[model samples]
Target chain A: MGHLSAPNDIEDLLRTLSPQVLGALVRRFDDFDICEDAVQEALLAAATQWPREGVPANPRGWLTVVASRRRTEMWRSESARRRREEAAFASAPADIELGAVLDDSLELLLLCCHPSLTPVSQVALTLRAVGGLTTAEIARALLVPEATVAQRISRAKQRIKASGARFRLPPEAERSECLAAVLHVLYLVFNEGSTASSGATLHRVDLIAEAIRLMRQLHDRLPEDGEVSGLLALMLLTDARRPARVSDDGALVPLAEQDRGLWDAQTIAEGAALITHTLATAPVGPYQLQAALAAVHDEAPRAEDTDWQQILGLYELVRTIAPGPMVTLNRIVAVAMVRGPDAGLRELATAERDPALTGNHRVDAVRAHLLEMSGDLPAARDHYRLAAQRTLSIPEQRYLAARATRLAPDDHA
Target chain B: MKYLILIYSNPQSREIWNSFSRDQRAAGLRDYAALHESMVASGELIVSEALADPSLAKRVTSHEGQALVTDGPYAEVKEYLAGFFLLECPSMERAIEQAARIPEAAFGLVEVRAIMALDGWDI
Candidate 1:
């Protein structure tokens, strides 16, 4: 990966490799920001020295050594009394196993996404340290002001420091619980890529790819975990339809209007195999069940051929396990498709009354669609406007506006 | 290499400070001590200290060729500048490393800036 060394280029390289390098350094230093800073200094040194030295044989290992040495030197120069004290405590020679440290970076990813932190903070830091995203990139993906993302990252780092969180993988006993957090983070990442809550384009393929890569890493490490397999299936099945989700103008193409031939057959096949394998082993988890439902949809050659009953059943299971407002909203759509629009409208009416579902644009959008299907053009138009007003994503807003436009003529006085 | 790490806090208002119990304060102090020890061991930290509450402090600023004095901080904010650390590091990277180690940064802010070099200024 040798190239012309410029300041911007150095920054780009640091952003790309910071997660792996900083994670390894944290294990060595047991301090997140210190490790990060040392790595930054090492990179700066590299930027100044590497061009002259023509890059090291193993750049990562070389950077780690340089950063670790810098830390020791800085410590020694700071205080004589503390240096003597540390010298007394540091009786044993330090081990510098770069390979093992690099391998432990995966564990750091899990820790970064731990449930202790808020989801926003978890996503921000995970993107920075695990996905190797710049703070600006994370800010853009999150649709937050760049300064906000920077503050969140700083606060998250400070909290991790104050809590004395270690740099090792969760113990065997806590692996299941810890793995759930990791999965949740990856799922959020993939979802952001799949639909993209807010962006000029409806999808961020890079984020989706990065998430798939991380999920594959998880599956490799924990082969017996059915949920891991389930998650992989869910992502693949959902991603299989990416090609058919948009038109050439980048406008969203509803599933019913999409050409089935455009779907990625390879992804769909892999997803179906994973889902089937997962189902055979144990009672399928929510992700696995969702993947199964998507598989049913994918199996159908046309929209009319979809097994709505099976999808509704899976939704029922998903709602029972992970009963969220979004799941309920999805369940309503399935009900409307299987039974009638009236039945879906009834389900949505109940969800709309729930305080937790209030202000949720997806619920409003689903309600509008059901109302439109049921021939209540006026009510559907109202809900469509509501959905458009509530949604922050440009793509979603455009979809709602388009739906409203399509229903406008019938609603006109 | 010379850096200024300012810690922001409000001393007059007990509301924010009182939110934490005695044990929490002790824990904070312990962490601060540990960080101080680490900074001292690292040999980059020059001098660090906490202020005696902003209520008891005064600000002197020059305005329009005249000296202006204020009874309280320059601005009325929820948090005030509570302490600082003057450090000499080899680079901005080291300065940030030390900044992150500050105890106040866990709950408050710690801004790190490099000191401007003067032609004939003596340390």
Candidate 2:
């Protein structure tokens, strides 16, 4: 534990150990709500003590013991008869073996993302129980009130308890579906972190890092699962481009215009290698295909070298497997690149008929890009302005408006 | 302390808003979004919302114990409350700073009113 020298290192270590400690407590006590609260107290105690007294010889064992003791004390504060039975049962000397406790993390994740809980609760609980973030940290990350986060987490634990979910993996029949839900939760967290929808905060970075760290832990446990590898690869590749995603003025820089030199090369290499390996070994999934797309964009030395033909083919696969409005819109952009803008516009006209695509700003943004490519400057400017007004994101609005202004005549201004 | 920042707009300003170009409208929305983002990040924002048009408002009155309802604009005031931000700030200056950041404050009045707690008033 001497490796935990810096304060930042200590924080990271605790975040990593938090789920394991909570998992062990719940497994022993069979009470998710009480166990979670006890583990949080233990964590707070450790957060304050470790730096002063030095890291304990066995951090996980130490936390498990402390949390178990707290659980007993909490039960003791109840009715005397209930306390006698609960306290005695809780204090029964169960070995807090480190190796066995490590396995509880995955089960904790599963229970946090149980089907009974809503998506919001799942996210809140997952960050609290698995990601080791405090309620305040989760509240700030999600931009909700601390009370709201607290309520969601408590509600989620109660739901899981009522569902009678065990402290182990779901049955074989439900394993894949449960895993998919877990993946979706992680995906949602990653996307929320990467985008920074409001466009002015550092809290998003913490979420991004936490999502990736949790994904890495999952990947480590299930090394043989390709989709897990694919999801992790996708996050790393997308996050790698973050450095070049925005300009100094806080405006979003489109992929084509971003400086390739500013991209994080090490992350790109790691992501590309992971995807390249997974794509070869595993059945194709949506996440793997998306990661493959990101790899394609990252591998090209310049925007001109972007293999659009291959991208179009991959989009075809994605649409065939899991079609959505955004997937269709992105496919149209690739269509414009490979074919001509007019060809893309024809497809866009039909795609816009879907009610899902109506009034979506990205559609207008795509239309503007195609119009510009087709030499219709006035029309492009109009669509850009319309798209700018339709978006709520400040950076996207500014970028679209700037594009519109750039195309306007000097006298028109 | 908690402060209520009221955003007011008059007919003249509404006309000006109607006359604005698409880019101007987008710019206004962007400024509002940025201000909201900053407030959220700074933990000053409790809640904020834009109200529907005043024309949609309904006025309710109790006349001789019977409830009566009618369309709004009971008085021909120069301005109306278009939106508001309920924020928790450390000081009046901080509240004022946030109020000034509201895009409407550039031309129209953005008032900052203190929210009185039960303990603040004497019997």
DockQ values per model? 0.02, 0.03
Give the local distance difference test score of model 1. Answer: 0.73
Question: Largest DockQ belongs to which candidate?
Answer: 2
lDDT per residue for candidate 1 within A1-413, as digits (tens), equals: 35446666665565555666776667766767566556657767877876665656677777777777766665455455876648724732145666665466567777787666766677778887777676677766654446666766777777787877788887889877887888888887887666552234333336788788778877877777889999999899988988887778766667777899999999999999988998999666888887888899888999999988998998999999888877888888899988999999887878888887877777778989999899999889988999878765556677787788888855543
lDDT of 2 at A347: 98
Which residue segments of model 1 deviate by more than 4 Å?
A1-20, A43-55, A73-81, A84-94, A143-146, A195-205, A358-364, A376-379, A410-413, B1-123
Cα lDDT tens digits for candidate 2, A192-219: 6766633445544378888899999999
Local error of candidate 2 at residue A227 (angstroms): 1.5
- List iRMS for all predictions: 22.8, 18.8
Clashes of each: 10, 0
> Candidate 1: TM of chain A?
0.83
Query: Which candidate number maximizes lDDT?
Result: 2
